[model samples]
Target chain A: MGQTNNDERTPTLLDDMFSVANKRDQAALARLFDHFVPRIRAFCLTAQPGSNLMADDIAQEVLIRIWNKAHTYNPESASLNTWVFTIARNARIDYLRKNGRYQTGIDPDFLWADDEDENADPFREAQQKRDQDTIRASLKQLPSDQRQVLAKVYLEGKTHKETSEELNIPLGTIKSRVRLALNKLTVIIRR
Target chain B: MIRYHPSIELLTEYSSGSLSLAKAVAVSAHLEHCKECRTQAHKLELVGAELFSDPAIPTSDQQLNQLKTNLLSKITNGEIESSFDKYGQAAPSVRMSKLQSGRPLSSESKYQIPKSLRQLIPSFYDDLKWMSLSPAVKIATLSNEKDGTQVALTRIKAGAFIPSHTHTGDEFTLVLEGAFSDESGVYKKGDFISRDARHKHKPVVTKDAECICLTVTEAPIEFTGWFTRLLNPILRKHHPSTS
Candidate 1:
């Protein structure tokens, strides 16, 4: 039933939804809730796994922010999707910072699924493809070893101890390598 | 002093909610004064959305509705107030009482700088040596105020030139009253300007009014020419900013 690709349709739908959401329109906000809550949950699960945070809780936080800050959204400065995701990301970070026990372990599954089947849900497929593209383009500038470590440590949700065991390196070395990797990744992502 | 770049990546992390608390507090203070970094942070937030999209989205509609109910109740009940207050968002305007508590005993109304900047100054204000630049521009040595730091209050006579000088250390100004302008921008009452070592500029007050500002300087001002050097001693010895 969807004609245009998600990159085009998702943003337009979100923009309308956001504009209505900005006006405090309940239905528009509901539509937005339907669309974004799941996206936030899935992303949080991938970005942070087994940290004991419920995806539903994070999704709720993201949605509440969407409602509260809807009026502050300026399309001239940021796209609708960017605005929404930024809200979600901030909600997650705030939650982790307050809780202090939330671990930011990256999942290895994120790396191995690049070549996975298209038949498995096109929306999820497209979203993963886009994130992979972003991670690859940004991380491509980093040294391979650093990228490898970050992908596993941050994106793959692996612990320093587990990564050290898997990579056949000492735990301290793994920590330093991951730190260096994050620094490099930060520079790239910022650029 | 580290440059307050508010780099896109840092902003992205901040907007995405992953930044550490201490660093976030520092960055929030910087954001208050820096327009360029704020814009950059907003842009990075856009980029972050594309970075987090997922294939098979989780968290269902019912759950989101339930969460919405809880959050609405929480907001109505003031749970969000504490979180907002922590980031200095609850109150952007500084209160007189709050300002007084931040500063040491000053007979005049206590000029409250932000907590981070206050830490840069020593507890004592009377220890700094005073110097003059012009009848209106006076500099004080803040060594006693805090580690070789200096404070000055420049009084720009109506239509006077503040003579060109290069900065060797950090310079801070809070316009207590009046107004002045340089190449970078115009500063009026309560507007603060912070110049790094690289900044070189001269300010001129308008003909209608005198400009009086409270300044905290971390380094010496390097006079640019022979004439300025000649005037330096007179200006330095006769500063009107003595406490």
Candidate 2:
């Protein structure tokens, strides 16, 4: 896979930017950085205890990744957002790992290959993503506490214990939050 | 650590994004072959997305676009995504089917029992006579052996109260429907409440909906009170193996 290092757009345009980036579209790259940079910097700035100067550096690094790997974008396989968030999730994990705060990495084999088995048919992946989209829409109905637990544990890569500590709640509470979140989520998604 | 079926919990976590990439990939592969967990995972994923929008963030259309761009660029080509064969989901054979058939009583006519649970019975468990516990509950005498161990499906009415009793042996309850409440707490669909000999309580299904649970037990219930004790013999005669 190719690699690039460019900086110009903001983070808000991430999804669109990725679609264009996948096509090796340079104009979209410009729009991409212009939209995402500030937010990325802000996120890094707030998330880290002592890091405002390096926020720009991290944000720049994240953008370069977008530019070089655009060809690998597979809309039929994964949504632009899921793909991006996955990237961000990994990057955040990488940052934490370097700081000894987290341990996670994306595998080289899993990201690019589309698993297009002739016998299995690859189109099912698209259908799966669509089904997931509907389920995600339903999860939006849950109350905030359950939502937050899911976000921190699932999205932010925090452990239940870590989440408990971070949220200043009990361990059992985390389990129940997850359970309730999932239960309510299942009900909504099935509909 | 709490022993949970990796596919079930990991799929739940993957859909929620709680699982690591290394792990989620494996779970994804398991999902490829296992339809039950895949459906559940998809449902969980939908729930995660639903929760995302619930938070009222002040992201203007412009900011939202920026966030998306930043995310896309991060993983465009950093590393090769792992293949399913190399790092497939870690699903022990024991838990896979127990985890898969989450429905109370599967509507699917062909009941393919997992090897782990299947090993418990002789060849004839499948052929056992199944009877209704109530409108919701169904019971089957898997073993007519002297020990009297059997497997049954208890489909409780939405608001039904299971006579509070104590288990004489290991009692495994896997939820197939709405939710159930015991002295412990409420258990929703897909939640597996496995109580060893130590647990004893009355399970009451909430008014929200009925609960159907697939329960496996070594011995029959020790009915708590005088009336319940009197009813025990009647219950015993109804079971194929006990009778």
Candidate 3:
């Protein structure tokens, strides 16, 4: 878990995001770019190794979206990291869909919209912060096997079935590993 | 009040952007009606965010600087392409209504098609080209994925019974309007029902109103009754799998 640098840098990144949104500050945008672009590129490369051209295009597209959709970002509902991560993910999906990989008419924009809950108050905000911290700390404690599956699914953009095949494990094992990982992270709330 | 939901693993995939678009559309429809699931999904996204922000993989400084310069120049040139402009003005507000409302829109003066499916269903579900399967059942295809998955809307007449059928593969049905009941239990608006090949039952719509459902079928379902069996060839032909 690369927590130390992020934990220190996140506050400034949040401020930079606010400046970009409220003042359209290019300086702040540049700062945000210097921070997130490499990470976004890395995320794309993880999913499509050796596809640097696609990576560059998606990374640039994601930064532009951040510049455009900054006003819509709500820190109460999501961290800046989470917000930017979603934008990057959607951009990657959009790129793949348009490049004839997915070949479906379904738009990724509608499938993943910001769930702006009207009832977001300080209590929930505090609860969300706690959840984020818990996930960060608990993620480190997860066994490597479970963590590998999670990384495959989240970073590599592999479905469970794909992960199963890639890892030479049964589909049931992949599902259970995911379940066990989420359980450790307390991400699954029993209904 | 929504009960049935996508399993946590499915929600995780949806949040991580790993689920196929067709199945993700079904989950999105369910989220429009289930705040609990929405909250769950949001939590899973936090996990994705944490993983996504893992220490940056280094890139060559020259390449990074070039991309940044290009992006900044574009911004200075006012060349940003706003998603709102491209996708239509209604996109953002549609997302608002979808997240804010938990109850099914069936009670409204008009049925509000879920925003996820609005790409296929423009104004009204009635506008789609519907083909009658029988006197009581009709279906309009929304999309056919390359992998043989079929996304369609099934409109069952009021108080009518669909012939008993078993799926050839997995089937996901989300009730869009009214209610329907099979041997298992009654399903109302916003309820997601997943049936595999093992399930074979007759569903009867409530007598009050016609029931409309958004169904994603992995393969064409097979009817069990002797008379309805004749329709299998037609169904297989229409399905992306056999076609």
Candidate 4:
């Protein structure tokens, strides 16, 4: 991915990630902490409102996971934000599964295991960057209703059914809105 | 090649981590074989990340410092060190090798369990406590969710026929081994077939090989045949819904 002049933080985070992975640098870990912990906390709080303890616990867990799994991060396969977002997402699911109403024996780690292809090539890397940029740019143009559904699913951790119930819209409408939004983002190309 | 795939809605929910664990298990198994769905799910994850990196909620400077201090102190005190050591020692590769070494030598040894299910099935499918639902059909319960969903594996003898049945709720079946044909179509390994209460059909395994499927049911299925109808109570009792 080309480093645009305005997006300096990407390279910095990439460097910090490498340092943490290769050298076990606590300073780099601290930098990562400052960058990701707040975002992770916000992500968790969006799912469980008024539960700062839950948010804090999940944030810490994600950071610790980043520390532990830093070496597995591959910039070519996914952006650092994407990598960390998944970690945060899985951490939230695990936290809920353990302590919240959604108790289950199923382990999130195996379900969402990092299965990125090991055979990375420059062509694949460019394609990934293009896809990432398209998604980021098109996401801004999605209509408010469509964007709302995406937010509910991705940010608030609501299933389509829950989103429908919470928004007082029909479940079919929720599914269609998600479909339309994903189509606009070109995230789900029909085969 | 895999034919039937999870719907876009299911893929989106699975990618966003909004789908329940039992349902996600079915999707994960399909992705293990269907590269197309895997690509779609990966793209969906990119969307999640883009939204995830939106402007933060702005924690207070004091709270941020306190959190960072707490984390650093734990790191400094070598608490994370001990945990890291434990993780490194018990790495998944090592455990996987250990499990492989313990598998019994047999013809079925070539059957590779899907990675998503290895957590529940340590080595082999034969190791599970398969209970006979009929002479030709046996099922081993894998997990029962608190929401009354049932995840299990159904093993059918070669050329065997499963009695016509209808679902009480949504049922997701991922073909794990061999192939089975129902009124809808033939489903082979990696094919994900989702059936709801409206569908009632019998499935027959291909004569060449026995069929094994990973099934996740939101509610127990009901058999339509009079003799098999008697089996509904047994199915319900085993399912978390009735009990």
Candidate 5:
């Protein structure tokens, strides 16, 4: 795996964020914002059809939430992305609904990643760095065709039908690509 | 053990954050029980996060650094957004305290309700005003802000059949207590069945005890049987209130 300092730092970043956030550490909060903001902004832009301005606003709100709701995050029920994105997706839906801009309908996509159910690690300060690196490496390893389909479907907020029409591929092909991509991801992640 | 689960397509939509609010709520409720699906959704979410971290998305360092400064200033100024206020709307938060009421009846002790489902309604025990549309069938509805996401706590007496109908859109049924089955298959507690327009069957509770379900419909059902059609008006009326 291509190791970046960001990747190395992120392994414990969530736990570090939680610990320092619970202490109301402003500097740690800033560090977290610097790290997660771009990715979250990207998420908002892709998951919802919003401008850079709107995505920034949403990212700001989501970061503020990470500070406020840090206590409520039970790391056992879900991983960092699951916990954070659940809040982000809900915030976006409610945000869009409040603005009367919720044209996309109630597509239930709360950002989640690997369920650690058999082992709910609420307090484990393990290799979140490795978790992220493995995930990124796994993603880097995916075939472009599979990766593109998965991206179009998940990130671009296109439904399978829409993805098929957009990519000019068969619906079955799209589904399989998604399955194969995820299945491979599961292997790499759990490895 | 969960015998039925939502399809990978639905799971994909769910983890990808493409499912609508109501359908998402239904799936969340199911995930509370089925650990396997929880793991699956979790994996898909990781996939989503990986895609989000793409270096190619082009969020500028200057723009991001500026945002970081702004965020810290906001926090330092004590403008930190509460989870309640993050969405920027004065939406009603579901009261969890209300759901902790006294037990409803025989089934209350029999099955563990998912916190996701429990948090949605005030009291699954007492708040469930199961209105009997017939002798053995009863349903109490909760309103959703979005249309067609009819959230209802439906109870069918042992050996009774749910309304025989064809779905106009997707329908999510999470069995809360006892067991029910149709031509498709048998569904017990924690078994989540997502049926689309192509699916048409009457769920019958063959277990000795009544079966309770948390159901979310993407659209109103078009009942096939003349008997169930009598519920068309009543059902239509209930849909408006159940959000």
Candidate 6:
């Protein structure tokens, strides 16, 4: 139903969606929404706990943003999934910042241009797929203690202090676990 | 030149969408000026994105199509800007208290404000209306910040001294130009200064040049000594900022 699945990271469908949206192709956008919305909704729910309403709100915002910022998507720079999920991450941050409190808004220079490797590999998608597989594998390799700390802090939106209190562990130990986990993850991602 | 920067924790919070808008604004401004922090923030956001895209999270079908409807309405109505055209979404409200009472007195000096600031408020010195809080300090207020927060631009003349004061809540000061010194340390352009109730110090402008700063406070100042405390009421009277 999607791109060549030699690697799931191939953004073939995403590429078509963005190019079509750039041309104001409504049908293409509708297709994109039907395919991606469920995934984004699920992702948002996992990222933020106990806020199904907030998760839905974030999914809506992510779609609107993707529709509006379609031209900004550089396929050469990142996979479409990474780009869409990036917007979801920022929207979640906005949800946490505002926290049911509405205000006008703030300046939006949040995204930065990352240095994409120009290694002339024809199989960029396959490479990215491999990278994704490696990243998830690395996630599994993390000690349960470290993964637990990260899941609480990054996914559940708990401060280290709250997580410490919840686990009845010292805050310093929790911080150390997160640090070690980040180092291990970075080494794996770079590999 | 950005010797001072927000901690990684703050940057992570900024990326996670959990920071208050005031803090978000300050972080945004700093990220615009500092490339290091910008890269750090991007990496952190990527990590968050990776965490979310694991494909194992559970989702619902309820109200799935409603989002598409909302988006289609905006796209069809010409409310949103297309890639071929520019979109300028005016903030719904700018009825800030300080905007009505007074405009800060901007100097004829040629210090250019950060270009990114124009996104939040007007930046040209002529357009800027700075109201003098003291002989040397002026504050140009911006939005009607919700949650009792105050967002404003402050300009301090060279060698002028800001009064020693503590805050009712968190105070964030980002140096946009020049430098200043308090009991804490010296701050230059791109330095993000944060203080709370436990910290009290008077920031004096560096001898070389006047300093321009963007300050967001959760509440108004509580002047420490008798003199500035007496001035506090007048400060509040003339400059009715939420912070």
Q: Taking the tens digit of each residue's C-alpha lDDT, what string does model 3 give over A1-191?
A: 45576568778888888898899999988888887888888889999999998888877777777788777777777788887888788888888898988888777777887445456677877798788888988988999999999999999999999999999999999999999999999988875
Q: What is the DockQ of candidate 3?
A: 0.61
Off by over 4 Å in 1: A1-4, A15-19, A22-24, A51-54, A102-191, B1-16, B31-36, B55-94, B98-243
Off by over 4 Å in 2: A1-23, A34-50, A53-58, A103-140, A187-191, B1-4, B7-243
Candidate 1 i-RMS: 11.7
Residue-wise C-alpha lDDT for candidate 5, range A80-125, written one tens digit per residue: 6656665565555656555665443332222222233456563432
Task: State the lDDT of candidate 2 residue by residue for B1-243, as single tens digits.
Answer: 112233234455555444444334334433443455544554454443333323243333464465445455444544323112221122234434544557244343233433223333223233445565446444564333333444555666778887768887755565545678887777765555657577779888988876655565656776787676775776667543355
Q: Which ten residues in a row have the lowest lDDT in candidate 4 chain A?
A: A1-10
Better by lDDT, candidate 6 or 2: 6
At residue A180, give the lDDT of candidate 6: 81
Q: Ten-residue segment with the worst summed lDDT in candidate 3 chain A?
A: A113-122
Model 1 lDDT tens row, B103-159: 555543333434433332334323334455667655543222223444444556677
Candidate 5: regions farther than 4 A off = A4-25, A48-50, A66-87, A101-118, A121-134, A161-171, A187-191, B56-60, B64-66, B83-113, B129-131, B144-147, B226-230, B233-243
Provide C-alpha RMSD values for all models, in order.
13.9, 14.7, 4.3, 3.0, 5.1, 6.8
Off by over 4 Å in 4: A1-6, A115-117, B56-62, B81-104
- Per-residue CA lDDT of model 4 for A44-139, tens digit only, reads 888998889988887777777777778977787777888888877887787888785577988767787543754567777778778878887788
lDDT of each: 0.52, 0.51, 0.84, 0.84, 0.67, 0.65
Over B79-194, each residue of candidate 6 has an lDDT whose tens digit, in order, gives 76522121223322232333455656346325544544655554354467778878888888775465667778889989898888887777789998889998879999999988
Against the hidden reference, what TM-scores do the models get?
A: 0.45, 0.43, 0.91, 0.91, 0.78, 0.70
- Give DockQ per model, in order: 0.13, 0.13, 0.61, 0.56, 0.35, 0.27
Model 2: docking quality category: incorrect
* Chain A TM-score vs. truth, each candidate: 0.51, 0.65, 0.92, 0.91, 0.72, 0.68
Clashes of each: 18, 55, 0, 0, 18, 12
Q: Which pairs of residues have clashing backbones in candidate 3?
A: none
- Of the candidates shown, which would achieve the greatest DockQ relative to the real structure? 3
Off by over 4 Å in 3: A1-7, A115-117, B56-62, B80-89, B92-109
